[model samples]
Target: MLDDATKAKWYRIVFDLKKQFGKKPDMNGLIFLIGVRELGQMREFAKHEKMDLMHIATCKLLSYEGYYKFEHIDEEGWPHYSLVQKPPFTDLMSQENRLRKLIVDYYEDNGLFEDMDQA
Candidate 1:
């Protein structure tokens, strides 16, 4: 379960990302944006490309918490991360909470949520 601080942080992240994008972005959408930012390309993502982008974002988020490890960026600039630890939560809701906590960690660790905290 996510702690109160994590839930609050997640709420702020959603608000901030929505403000940045000018619309409400769901978990997948926010992760896709993070993936595109990581990929260093903001261009339109095709349907197939979006899947890969979401995967990249998942890896990126997991890497921070030791569930994955960054390996290398491919020639096309796609990131590759090797699984380092099995995820503890397996159920859908638990998995979602874990991701939410990790996403909050992502924003906090990267200073992305600093602005949110100030306001």
Candidate 2:
């Protein structure tokens, strides 16, 4: 399980992403930022940490939004990334602002921020 400090950092990243771009993020984008790992590997990591995949995905998306860079090896021995200079929060917002809004709305509807507020 992630420590409280880490969780707080993750939440801050998520909130900042929303504030900066006014949007939520895609799962694939999040997975890529988390390390470009395969789905099965991600699942395993989540299981090991006793966290849900959705939660992990959310945290990773936020991390990416907060400009946490990831490095992965491509076939050409070069690096690949979910974000290059910075996380593509603005680009994602442009591509699917409405969808992003809907996602944040759904999270609010589901009380995703209740715990944060309590803290």
Candidate 3:
């Protein structure tokens, strides 16, 4: 289970995202948004591309922890990464918590939070 602080940060993230985008985003949606931001392009992605975006988001998020390192961006503007180390977490809950914390970190790093006093 998420600790109280993590839960509060997660709630602020979702709330701010909804307030900005005019829709609530679940975990997958947040991942997708991160993928879009990383891609630096806003366009309709095909179903397969959507999956690829999520993969990119995963790699990018893990990269923050030094699990993955950015390799290069392809001619098509797709970023690639190499796995440096596998994630330390084994169980689903732990992995989710890690990702949640990473998401919060991402927002802070990007200065996306408007009123982070609550966070």
Candidate 4:
């Protein structure tokens, strides 16, 4: 469980990223952004490809929890993950909490918060 200070810090980080991007990104949007960054291919995506990107992000996040496993990147440069176990959350709030933890874990793991002074 996250302590109060840690939760506040995450909220601040999310808010700051929202400000930086000049929009209030919802959970899905944040995941998409994270997915795009993970994709490492800065280019336009097709309208139908957004869901695929989000799936990629979801897989990436869930992998840390042992629900997925990272496989090799394909020739197209997209990363693939295989299911290792079922997702840990079921209900709406629980799912949201899990995603929040995943987001914070992503930043922390990648040192994305090391220079987060603006928040």
lDDT over C-alpha atoms for residue 112 of model 1: 77
Q: Per-residue CA lDDT of candidate 1, range 17-106, in tens?
A: 778779888878888878887899878879999999998899999888788899999998888989998878589888888889888877
Off by over 4 Å in 3: 1-5, 21-23, 114-119
Number of the top lDDT candidate = 3
> Model 4: clashing residue pairs?
none
Per-prediction CA RMSD (Å): 2.2, 14.5, 2.9, 1.9
lDDT of 3 by residue, 3-45 (tens): 8887888898888788878999888999999999989999999
For model 4, residues 3-118, the per-residue Cα lDDT tens digits are 67668867976788877998777899989988998888888999777888999999999999999999989999899999999875488877887888888889888878876763
Please give the CA lDDT of all the candidate structures: 0.84, 0.44, 0.88, 0.85
Which 10 consecutive positions of candidate 3 have the poorest summed lDDT?
110-119
lDDT tens digits, residues 1-119, model 2?
34465445545647755665577644444334333222235334444433344434444444434543445645633333354344345565453543343344434554645655665
Candidate order (TM-score): 4, 1, 3, 2
The number of residue pairs in model 4 that clash at the backbone is 0
Q: Candidates 2 and 4: which is better by lDDT?
A: 4
Backbone clashes per model, in order? 0, 0, 0, 0
**Candidate number with the higher lDDT (1 or 4):** 4
RMSD of 1: 2.2
